[model samples]
Target: MKKQYKRFRLRTVSAMVAMAFVANAWAVDPFTVRDIRVEGLQRVEPGTIFASLPFRIGEQYNDEKGSAAIRALFGLGLFKDVRLEVNGDVLVVIVEERPTVADVEFAGSREFDKDVLKKALREIGLTEGRPYDQSLADRAEQELKRQYINKSLYGAEIVTTVTPIERNRVNLTFTVTEGEPARIKEIRVVGNKAFSESTLRGLFDLDTGGMLSWYTKSDRYSRAKLTADMEALRSYYLSRGYLEFRIDSTQVAISPNKQDITITVNVTEGERYVVSAVRLDGNYLGKEDEFKSLVTIKPGEAYNADKVAETTKAFNDYFGNFGYAFANVEARPEIDRANNRVAFVLVAEPSRRAYVRRVNIAGNNRTRDEVIRREFRQFEASWYDADKIKRSRDRVDRLGYFKEVNIETSDVPGAPDQVDLTITIVEKPTGSLQLGAGFSSAEKLALSFSVKQENAFGTGNYLGVEVNTSKYNRTIAFSSVNPYFTPDGVSRAVDVYYRTSRPYEDQGGNYQIATAGAGLRFGIPFSELDTVFFGGALERTEIKPGTNIPAAYLAYAERFGYKSVSVPLSIGWGRDDRDSAIAPTSGRYQRVAGEVGVAGDTRYVRSNYQLQQYIPLNKQFTLAFNGELGWGKGLGGQAFPVFKHFYSGGLGSVRGFDQGTLGPKDVTGSTIGGPKKITMNAEVITPFPGAGNDRSLRMFGFIDAGNVYGENEKFRLSELRASVGVGLSWISPIGPLRIAAAHPIRKFPGDRIQRMQFQIGTSF
Candidate 1:
């Protein structure tokens, strides 16, 4: 019976095909020589239909041409049904146009914005004003669901509604039911014998919901995150002498409700092997000694994958420094099962030398090409030196005008010894409007605002205006800097400022000091990380007399008059190599500055030196230290200017004392800043609780010791005030913020202590 039915089905298909051929032959004959007419087009133009027709007016038409015309019109995606008819010799082309999408809307979607959903649909050809089909609507629903799945919304449901409107148009509404996102309920690590399960799980960023899970989202299950976590797990073992460590399998299981997930990582921690021997086995360009020095793998120590990888990378980079762009360096291991040891053979291959054919820059929509090109150390038509290319990339990154910078090397076609360098950069907004406020014990409320353009007009210049209003101090300043002033890496800067300072405690005495100055400076690049600066400034200071003025200020006014003018020469040197300017993990920074009052009413010299160092202890901890020293002395038989003294005991110095209130005092019991200053700070920083390894949010414990001394007083350890505190540092949207609550370990009589303080734009 089955065989008979199959024969009948084949006969039916053949009969249908024969009928179609006969009907096509009858409908279209070989005659044409007349005009054509189109029917059933509302939005699409008649010319569009005529353009797609295979046969034109006054042309012979046949059955093959009629079939081709129907196919061509349908291929345009504008028509749903196309028919060709013949009335005598006048050809009639009829089409039913697809509905035009009038609008796209979303409802009941909280995980994504309406515009975001629209954009996602548009990428898949389902936007408004385009032809609509049932298949397209079905695809839009699947795409929306996929987007939600990425957000861990496994139970999300999308229902597409197609509403027919007037003029053969339709409205597409994607109503989304975004259910609760799936949370990670547990993480299990199997086959880790040397470490506890909890310890192994702690290495992963995905965790069972923590108290702060809402912000970190670490409790969400993500395939990408799970992959990264597995890599970390493998690295941890390999770095600790488990030479044959590997991840066997990773299983992510979702609950029946799709609201909870469990992740299990199975790993194999093989035998721990020690290094037995290391040998060089390949061509080293007759510089074996030089290449051997770059090996970081210890012969007698436990086998470390990190050290092995470092050695190989160093060899490759060294080879690239000599124009060998295609150098291959590999470390092959020989395992000794009985002795539990491994031997490494370093193999090196330096391919043909290459020169840069062209250096291309891209993605700088606003910045000029020259602005980025000038920073490159590796130029076109030069030998490809990897070191120089790396330096060039770093230089452009330090410009602070780009959010991302990448360099790619590609071989030029048909050229064996030539390559092209493409430097792609993602530019960021260089203009900023900053509004800051800080609260401290002494300076109760302080407000600051600044407008700055780091890359003004894409000329690699800086222009800024700053204003500060505090109860004890007020300032307004304007500054401009040209980084390429003379084209030899020389920088020129100009500054104009006005400032007023008063005592923290008013006490009905409005005695104040007003100063105004303007300066021009030039910086000469001594090296890649060092700069020397020299400048001259003209300044005027006026001391307004009132009740309860400090005796030192009164004496200075009596000696040099109430108003004084000075022209000071300034010289400074700075060097910074920190990994990050905002959140440093490792590096050192130093600065030395001095001012000499060569021709002024105040004939004194002042100098200051500061050093900061950041040491990364591990993946999650950093140790930082900062120290500053300042000194001023009378010169030409004149006392140091009272207004030029250094002040300590603030957010940037000792934290447990009031701002600028840890120094000598006047007879009226007001804090008077001194000419000598010393500050030392040390902190241990770690990730904030439940934040995983995010460095932007962190907590720290700090120890601060510093003091200010009168010019006549000697530097003594007993006079140094010390404090221990815990602080929070966050790279917030506004700026870097720090909050500290400290307890002074040592305090003297009449010392003003402020235990809690918070401020912006400070790091310690």
Candidate 2:
């Protein structure tokens, strides 16, 4: 019965087609009232067109509706042709569909990446698995030609070949003629009043003669590079007080040979403007005084509109901290025509009270979404808090995974009532090696090396090995760190270190120490700019016998010596927004760490602290300062720890002084553990010539001062050893290299202070 039913259905369709054909054979007119029937459809059901058609069965057909129906079908790109036939009291429509593109394949596409070709085609609505028509194919060819032109191939041609295969599908190939990449022969900057032509040309990345120009291909007519040049021009004018600068025109001339290009940029220099007055306008949430203080734009200050706008945003943020989630701030700049100045009026308004819709993170390909979302202080479906936004940016930046972090707020186009927040970031190399070598009088020669992979196997795991060997000391350490413990910024680390050192004067006498431990480190990002980490770990160590050991240390070892164990608890805080990890001038970096023994076979509480700051003086200059302090003590009859102590005055500490030999000593003059010490330095940093702006080849002038003392010895600042010196730092492929030369401002003959000393990769 089922088979018979199916046969009947087929016969019914065939008879309908036959009867319609017979009627059409009687000299049918193109347009007439008749029975309407559709043909030439297989994949697309008949009902789809039947529902879309304006005319019904036996209805009169006009040229307008017939044309409209044909246009609608063609618009779908699924049909090759749609024509109408009219017989007396009958109508028939016939169509032939264009083939669906089952797949897209590329051949000989190394010169132009396959992805680039696919994207070009996709822009013209031609892609894999989509139906294609003649118009679309033609458009694809045009786009291909345009892409080749972008590569400076003026003579390039594109031939599209379509091949029909099985399954009513077709394959497409865009045979390309990739011409040689053109080079820029000359670049001219016109109508420039603020700076010289040479200066303006230097602002453009497209160099007329450069080795890298061939690779970056900026010499080609790149719209992106041209746009960047325009921006550079705008910035150069604004920084010099040009308030309304404009780019009038840009032109590129290709040679007849199609191998050389000449570029011309015309700019309009606007009049420089100055501040006339500063005014504050807008609703202040009963705290105008507080808001006014945060405003950096003063009446007498120069007209820096950017500063005024930033000040306004800061006011809105301040209100956000007070739970005013929808605080709005705007700055109004009023011009003083006679005085040639501008005034800024700051205003704020607290609008509808609302919470956050959802906090979403984007552009983290290697890291999991939960890994980033956990750092958010602002919860999903919670109030939109500016403070939380800033905090989230900071928190994400601190992950050490991103080189830049940017946040944007956008409204859903059709849904004006809804908003979406986007967090975009640029990933950077997290794993690094700290390798160094240098020569110094204090230690004769020195070398320090450390290998660290912060993101092991792209899984956010870290492994490290550190070795510091010199004439006076030798150390080897193996360690591993996980910044994400349970995927929420909870960190963990395991370390094992062994050291053997020869004391100064007793150059042949050696002492050995070893330590092994594992600990957890977690961060609490209380604010966008602040994070604190506190954790503990158990450790075991062995102190081997050696000569040149201080009598105090020897006696202590005899009493409670040889082998011991302990647990150390540590806490640290860090904030780094530096533009560069190795050499930064535009941002700030700060960190503090302290550790104390809590439990084990021995009892001790030891702590150390360090502070560093960087200030960018200019494009090629920076001012930096660093200070370090350490303290150690014994508890429960345990001996004063040797490894826990700090010895200052070296390449990484105070230059011009001997390493480990800077602090005080006993009768034998061995480097006995000092209870406390401090090192302070200030440096003016600059890029080294021949190395460009390489973080590895940095040079600086520095001032250093430090001293160590016994626990009972009075902390005397007046007796601090001060040295002024010049330092150099480099990130060589082998590792980081550092060198410093100093002349002690205050020194006694044979004071063990070296005129030259280096321990690699440290400045000031």
Candidate 3:
């Protein structure tokens, strides 16, 4: 009976205690506030805290209002903690403010630049002077890790340290350990039936390390490069008639140490297809036969996706010629599964013709808008023609002021038939300062330099100055060109130069020539691919007597005087259709120029014609041929001037022979004036081995033949010297670089040979 009574008493006490606790937790009483006070703020003002409170100085305060004020104040992200204290007729608010970020620093960051990392962090709301939070620091570390991973730096580690500085601030220091980039150890291509594994892997830019891995960097594992390689592999098969080919899966695996990687690509190669027939199914605007002529796909040939794509593009371009800016051309293949043959039907939809509403030039931050706009052939409010638009883009690109140029057409709102053409360009530095030095056994140490500005002061005018300090060759030259000298794109160039050519380094030559000249040239556009040039120059030549002057030079000086003044006139015609000035793939260029000394002590006529053709055999191979013919004749029974002679043999003429050493030599072992010259070059060009698809660097095997004929000698094939060699060409940062190793196939007894030659800055 006593134990039961004690249990009943304990239960009653527990119930009473629980009821008191519930009332204290959920119950609140309404009160009227007389005043409000805020404390514990370093930078934030008291008014800011007061405004954040739900209840004002004289407003009524209740449990809901108190909860709202607390919530609102915390949402500002300014305070680390907040508290509320109530005294009789007074409300006190106390808060702990979050520290501001004082400074952000980076250490051991080699892969990514410090400014780059800071900028990225700033984008994620982690800049200095902002409120610092631990969660934000964690997020920043993760973000940096993600960036490193994209660069294939799997072993990279980021450690963020936060240190409290003076005046309620903290400094963030991100210490990074970026290890070596992951390398591609293996690449396995599975289920390729038509092509061998090695052949398929050859199409990829990412591969196992090779002998030239340091240069090509193909051994590195890059996600972006891998994606591009996959696309190339697909194109290779698609262009080779495997229309149904598909990549089933791709797996990229990293080793435990994060230093090695392997890629596995599984693909299904379907049956090869042949083109049974090709039909055009669109209104070619009364030019069906013309469009048909543009088709490169033959009916009896194998199905080539490239040919089909080309045909479709040709149809679209043809439609665009008729003012169809929104042309839709598609090649729909009709597959015959049983016979393994495909028939392609080209369908075109030429929507309403569009007139250009506006021609906009964008991304010309450094260049003037007029500079880019003047290159446009398609005008505002004119009919849209694809060919003209393409030409405009190419013209702007050819200016060499931009790294990239793109054109986009947008349909004007509420005007379905009108479109706005926007030309976008990425500007590059047009000013160049080149300083170079070279050494050779014969030429000794030579120093050369030039300062050039293609777009001087954003005016699209070229200015250049060159100086050579070589012991054998000393020159000073100044040149300028104004491309917009005339409204019709006629260019004008002015040049002034002083040159002294000596035959001996010790200044022991019997004779030396000093020339001071100035010329003005103008280029008149005759057509899209042709130009006519006219120029005149006045030159003063002084022959300095020395020890071992050639007999011919002495005789001429005696008859014409040591000092002679000549007025030369020049006229020329040129055409250029090559794709790139630095690396031409397919096109033909021809030029013919003639110069005559009409009013001077020396009277002569000199003419030269040059032709170049580049033929693309495939994406990887090219055949280039160059031929030149030069002739000179003296007027009024005088011999051709010694300095005006044409000499061959060198890097620019015939390799394997010494420079200007291929003509007839006098008794003093010096090459004299020549009346006739002929030179020819044939090259089989290919992409550099292991550099895969890099057009900037290429390799070629060349055959060169050239010879100079003296005044009495006639042009003959037997007199021509020949050479065969392998060479390399690279478009370097400053200019084009070429190197050649040659062997003379046909040479005379006294022919001087220079088997290895290199040039730093010159065009192909």
Candidate 4:
């Protein structure tokens, strides 16, 4: 429109000039003498035109300057074009304007969503019904293509189709084509020294074949997998004594098909060193002997960095126990190159003797922090006690509420001589219940039951009932434990029980006996994890002399009293840190109980002691050992108590033996009471998911060695009964279900058959 107006005005101006030229023959010099006049501009006001012109009215009307002024006015984007006319001292400027845009629209764009497509077009400044351009339309198509590529659509195509509409306008539609995503087809591992190809392949999440591979995203070539694979490789070597090793380089190669990936890791293996000696290097403030006592490493041993680190830690801890919160210990090594040995030099520095600023407990979701805090001996604003911190860790660990307990220390910010301790924990189920049923040979068609709530009602209290029934006799019991019996941390317990069972007779005969008892027990802490308990019980026992009953038992019972009522006082000491109540991997537990018939009218005093300890054979295996000793002697010419007699060859007592059919046999071939018995067992536990690390809820192979002899028989290791087998167990709501198919490795002649047994809830 602007160009057309310019042509029209040029014609008019030329015509006027031509006519003036004709009228001014021989007087051309007179044209510039008259006044200038303007015409044909509605918006281009005359005052605006004069302001735009470089020449004044009195100046020469040169065509170059006059035309330049008109071009400048049209370029303001305010005018479509400006026309100039020069007619005998008259200048005319005519302008035509362009139309404005109102709105823009899109249709059928689902691939890139409308908003994103709109943004793509806005980059080129195209929107609404704004003044459109062919250049912006072309650029918009390219911009949309770039966006699609980012979504992995390398084969994507974009087309912008413009439609002309009413009043010199058009509509633009960006059409796109999105292609399929590329999938990885294969993966390969390279440069493995510590393991085989199949082993290494098993370590990687990425794999070559399987229908479910796509769901697991195992076929995707990812840097994350590569990094994790490297770590796995590193751990495998480190665990095998390849400590000084490094992964030199790694390469990820994509196949020509672009769907397969191959990874290669190059590693460097360094020399393995042995520890020759350890010597302290730093000033111990003339207390070298005291610090030296903390060293635990042996001189002529393989280099165990862990032990050295532990020794240094012990030194630091000892300092902290004496109010030095910032004690530091560093282990420096001097290599004996010629002898292929390494010597360690220990250094200790006490940076500061600081006080405790705060002690915070964290990561306890179910247990209250106060419950744990009460166990601490270290107080805020008091001198930091490393010993207390360790004790605190032990206290929390002993609670059986966490899988791991860790303490993190940091200097109180802006406080030079203050420290804050954070106890971070990984909470576990402190409460456990096992409900199960099983059958055994000795206890034919037996049903074992137990209901124990370790953390009863979420308060860390305990209550339980346990019963084992057989054709012979059934025993029922009820027990309660208040972990925090008193505000001062003493523990209290109550137990009530009744048992009625026919004593299994071998040769003579079988008979029935019934017994009931009640007791109150109180515990005082000997240490954070140790406790001493004292209790008194009133027990009544009635013995029905059987034809199979050992002559000695009957003879003694006749003198003790047909139905005896006795009150007994018992004292016991227990300390347990094993990870589990039934089975432990890395912890130890001990129990010793003895009772004397002080208050009871019985003529005998009876006592028993059982000690158990657990040690980890590996991350997945635990070794457990146990021993038992018991004795009952006549008092005031009276007989021993029948209910407290020792019985063995059961699920908990012996793996392959039948329940309650073990002990000293009567003269009539009945296995009767024994004055004492001893037992031992070893187990290897493995994991089965859906169950936590409760030893009772795992699959394991075990070797049990022990036997129950007569009460008067001497304990000897050579006479121990040994049983070996694989067992399966899991926690049920009623009790632990443990089924072991065992073979008695060593059994005496005429011993009862105990090939396989299923026992629910047995503790060793």
Candidate 5:
């Protein structure tokens, strides 16, 4: 016979006191639980229910324990309903589990990708394989809206749809309707007494829609950009001697349709004060005079906040050079209202000196740890030298393998005199495959292909292959460089190449010069910015006979045979400190190379030198100058090889002249490039009109002068070709592009003028 039983049920708790009262009313006498049973579970495991119960088998159960068991199960958030039933001395647990999310999808989302939306939802705990909840779906919708708003899409709408599927799962889809972005209609500056309103407003990056707004998108409103613009405005005034300048308030307004936005900035331009004096008041390690020399604030000049800040930063960095990592330096100003003058006091505190306890590397998932470690100058357990740390960071950044390299210092927990340096790097793809095609007057049609890996196999080695097919020139080359061939930072490079060239002429010709060579080079680092290279190559040249060939080539081929061989020894030196290799704003670069054919059918000595200097005139303008010189002479009573002569004209040299046409001419009127050359170029570069301050696209006016002289001719300044031109430079997606329109200012009777020139992947 079945045991007699009285059943009691418990549901979710509406109120704690009510649950207890009802539980007590139906409470059963304390009895040892003989068996526990769980029912109505769809997906939840039996063990899960059993573990959540307050009392186990052979334990006493009552109203108090039963209430706790219900609360514990509900806290798991996996159940839609939970119930507890009692039969005699047995406890029955039942649960209806919540449905899990099967998949997440998006529809009509043009502003953002579906994967981005899915990741956003995942961050908020509302993703696939998780229990579905209405509250979490609501939060995900809000998050989607926030992302759209950041892009100036104020009218974006989101609809979340939950479709139930089989096996207690649901699929979620978010449908988005993204409207047009709100544009900045106007920007106004108020309460500006010292400067004109237009001048002050011009300082901000955000502006009314301009002609190039479609490209720049500067007209779009962004709160973060506005905050930065406000800071820039403040800095401008402070740097210009407005010592008490401040931003009073800022107001942003939107149209009723939410299609246009307006921003107004109110500023206070207080009295401009002159600097009365600057005094240093702190311990200087008995080097007060040395520290005093670092001060840049002039006593009689205007009170410029930039100079004050610079002085204080110098003091702090100077202190850090001595291992004081936590140095504090502050510039306090004493204002004299009546005299309209100010005095600055620089206060410094040298904190405890610390040594690097450990040097940790992180975030270089692809590059080897040793690749980054070898570039570091600051070592573990060494004195914390800020200069060395900065140099280490710079060296790693110059490797071009990582998009970002950052170093952070943190104090050790237990040791006061020890710190940890964590170098974090964001690795970027160092390999590139490029395919390009171009059409020109001389080359007609040209195609180029290249494959390069700057950090090959994470080994900090360089590997490259390049192929070019053009009408006048064709080349195929393979190269590899081991940047750290030895432990002492010497670099080794190997190159194998084949090239063919033909003289440019109106009438086509099959006559060509073919060259094949191999070379090995080693670079020795003389300093951080200087490298010396020495190399040797075995080259063979073959002069193919055909029509319209230059007389010089025929003469050389007849005397030295159709084929000639040379073993040339080369030495070079290079120093580059440009801020940017592609779009340099400031710095200088210099290179000198010389080659001597020591043994072979041809014997010659050739040398070339180049210098480039970029001077930044202001924030938006740069003045650049370039100069080059070349000279070559025959050795061992042999004439210089005609194929080794220098050419100067067109895009890279003197614009407005035909390519390789600004040199000596042979009897056939074909331009035979000479053994001596000189070129000079100067440019004033500025931002493109309506492009704001974008450096990637700029316009420049340039003056070019160059000429090539024969081997026996004297160098004459009067014979130098000169041209003036205006050009546009763009760092395009494919490469750097330049287009110039020029007029010859100094030209000879026989000069071949092109008037316009353009090219890609070339720098002057």
Candidate 6:
């Protein structure tokens, strides 16, 4: 009987579908809707039917009106079938309402969340509580397929099943079969005569799977990546003097099983061209010579599109500084095929100056508006200065509370000379809890932890605590910083710390130097790239007696009665122009710090200076150089305190040597440090193999030279120790990791060699 009922239901549904199609052509003589009635509605309201009819109670109805009403009802997408009928002076609307979607379910969907799919379906009118149509179901299926294609899942399949439930509702189930993502089988470049195909392919991010494929994921095929790779290829050729180079075509094909993809790019390598002349053509505002000086392209040099673009951008920025926010700059190239050379004319059009009507902030869902507004150097109602605007944007970005920051200027309505600037920001987490570990031949196994909030409670204040647990060195510290402590952008910071250090771990029985201190500091901004620092600290140092104590430390402990108190005053200056603090490509950073012990058990003066410069050789290569120097002397004819010494070696100083092991040693063969330190490092950095131009993962070859000298020891080249190494730097989920395998270029009999060294979450 159940089987027979199911067959009957199928037959009835088939007949109803046929009738609906046939009704499209059927017409009825309509009359006034004196008392319209509706049937076959389970969820739809009666008024809905009344509102859909074209004829009112007192209006005359005709055959055309009856047909039009039927079409209008169907257009609502709420009914599977709509019909209009008349009985004497009355009209009736019969509607077989579509089922409402009660719930949506997913199975075997790992590529995306079920809610994501439901949200996408909701956009197309197929969500729960809404009418369900078969056409809408088909569109949802296509949307799912599109999403899968973007993930390289070419073999993915989706089956949507609709099952009728109680109360004229249905349950939708979308079963997904997500196969393996398509991998790049091969990348071929055709008609590249100047460069080898392998070399060109090497420039692409997408490639066949390799040993590191699981980590880098560069083997996957993506249309967006392919497009970017093509652009890079074009840029490469243009920058290398192929000014007329053109891409012929590109073809990407998938395998029969959809598990592999191949890409072929065809290009025409035009003849290399050199620059014949460069000239400024438009009004230079009486600064034609100044504008000409900004030109980087020179005659007799290879025609570089990058340099041309840079020169134009410089012109635009220069104009912007003078309130010409809408300046137009163009580089017009005149190619001479006969001589294989090109001439460029720079044209500029400085549009009318405009004042900023308003400065709007957006997308700061967590951070307060004041936090962002305070960083702006450009004010509302002020003439637009491009340099100041750019600086303001960078300042907000440097706050590090946002993942992305962008600014757009739009013309204000009815004000030809007024514009509004909208600053949009995408906020990221401003808090982090880091747990790190490190292993060094000298320090051995060390564990460190830190909890910091850069924007505390969204108030734009920094608070942090840190602890380090190593047998040779242990420390606990607390710190706080307020960047806007002073209305003029001066920053205030407070720090308190306790540290215990064992100078020697190899032959040590816990002979240690301990210190406890607190400090307050202020940073005064001198310019966009410079800052001056002033601070004072009160510290106390204590020495604990133990076996195998270094002679220098023992003598100091005896002379100072095992403890000493000091008041130190510090002054410092710094300048930074790096593009990024984490992964700088080009810029210079420098610092000079000095401290004097004014009134204390130990009176001395210390000064330190450091300089770092990064030069970008090209898009993928950089050269970095760093140098550091330190010196200390005792005042009032007292000896320099042993606890206030400097040590060198290990990752930051000399990678091949053990940590703090390149300095003077005591009689018991323990490193006692020294009063003078010098270190210099040079590195050639490049993108990691198979990682394309990713800066977060890089590899570098470095040369290091450094040593620590005693107070009476004079600086000498012969005393410098050096090493050479290859290293890798990865910005991992937890923190930055650095590993190096180094070899010492200079060594002594007692020098400690530690070739493999690594650390996490700390700078070198």
Identify the leading candidate in terms of lDDT: 5
| lDDT by residue (tens digit), candidate 4, 1-764 | 12211122322225334433333332222224145555545434577766766666566655555545655665454344456555556545565533333445554445567887787777777777455556667777777776764443445666777777665556777666565433445444455555677765665555554554433445555566668767766665544444466778887666554434566667775555677778887657677898888898778766665677679888988888878877788988887766667788887888778998899988988777777787778889898898988887887777776789998889888998988989898877755455545554555567677877776655777889898777776889999988787877888899999988755543335556778999998999977778899989888888876555666567657766658788888898888776767555777777888788876657566677777777787545666677667667667765556656777786777777666666676665666656566667777776433222223457878888767665456777777778889878767655677788889887878777567777555765
Off by over 4 Å in 3: 1-106, 111-136, 163-172, 438-444, 502-512, 545-551
Winner on TM-score between 1 and 4 is 1
Candidate 4 displacement at residue 202 in angstroms: 12
Evaluated at residue 728, the lDDT of candidate 5 is 93
Top TM-score model? 1
| Superposition error at 481 for model 5 (Å) | 1.7
What are the runs in model 1 whose C-alpha is more than 4 Å off?
1-26, 36-51, 85-94, 163-169, 434-443, 503-511, 544-551
Measured with C-alpha atoms, the lDDT of residue 45 in candidate 5 is 80
Q: Can you list the residue pairs that collide in candidate 5?
A: none
- Candidate 3 per-residue C-alpha lDDT over 621-722 given as tens digits, one digit per residue, 9 for 90 to 100: 999999999999988887788778887877788988876688877776776648799999999999788777678888999999999998788889998899
Model 5, residue 541: displacement in angstroms? 2.7
* Clashing residue pairs found in predicted model 3: 510-546, 510-547, 510-548, 510-549
Per-residue error for 36 in candidate 3, Å, reads 11
Q: What's model 5's lDDT at 18?
A: 59
TM-score, structure 2 vs. true = 0.64
| lDDT for 711 (candidate 6) | 85
Better structure of 2 and 6 per TM-score: 6
What's the residue-level lDDT of 202 in candidate 4?
A: 61
Clashing pairs in 6: none
Lowest summed-lDDT stretch of 10 residues in model 1?
A: 1-10
* Full-model lDDT for every candidate: 0.88, 0.69, 0.84, 0.68, 0.89, 0.86
In angstroms, the error of model 5 at 484 is: 1.2
lDDT-wise, the better of 2 and 6 is 6
**Runs off by more than 4 Å, candidate 6:** 1-137, 161-174, 434-445, 546-551
RMSD of each: 5.5, 9.1, 7.5, 17.5, 3.2, 5.4
Question: What local lDDT does model 6 show for residue 112?
Answer: 92
